[model samples]
Target: MNMSTELIGMVAGGVSTAAFLPQALRIWMTKNARDISLLTYCILGLGNVFWIIYGIEKSSLSLVFTNSFILITALVIVYMKYFIIKD
Candidate 1:
């Protein structure tokens, strides 16, 4: 991997991981995951898990690290949505 490609990968990973923060913050603060689709994120969390595995399989540092971190956060959101709906 050349320096330019590595930089692009790093940038892409950072952007994607950071993209989740705003939605997470909104959900955390408002506890209003009503706007968020439960089924969608349930699927999304599972997708994140798969991506994490794919990243590992491919030995992709950016994908592995970013997806793992995002998956943790995404799962948190999924759980939060479930609990909120339950209550």
Candidate 2:
């Protein structure tokens, strides 16, 4: 991978995934996933899974690494949304 592309992914993924942290923290703290959109997160989690696969196909470690972390975290949010989030 080119330095530029890696840098871009690092920037985008770092920012986006880091952005996911506050909601995660909130969900963990309050066990409240009410504000989280189940469908949106589900789709997002699936998208991340596909991203990891695509990363593997492309032999892109950064994409795989970032997406893996995001997928787990997002799945956690999804789970919390199911169990903790009130309808």
Clashes within 3 Å, all models in order:
0, 0
User: Mind giving the per-residue lDDT tens digits that candidate 1 earns over 25-71?
Assistant: 88888877877776877787788889879878876777778877788
For residues 1-87, could you state the per-residue lDDT of candidate 2 as single tens digits? 898898898788888789888988988888676677878888988999999999999988779989988999888788778876665
Worst lDDT run of 10 residues, candidate 2, spans: 78-87
Evaluate all candidate structures by whole-model CA lDDT and list the values in order: 0.78, 0.85
Alpha carbon lDDT at 59, candidate 1: 69
Per-candidate TM-score against the hidden true structure: 0.79, 0.81
Candidate 2 accuracy as lDDT: 0.85
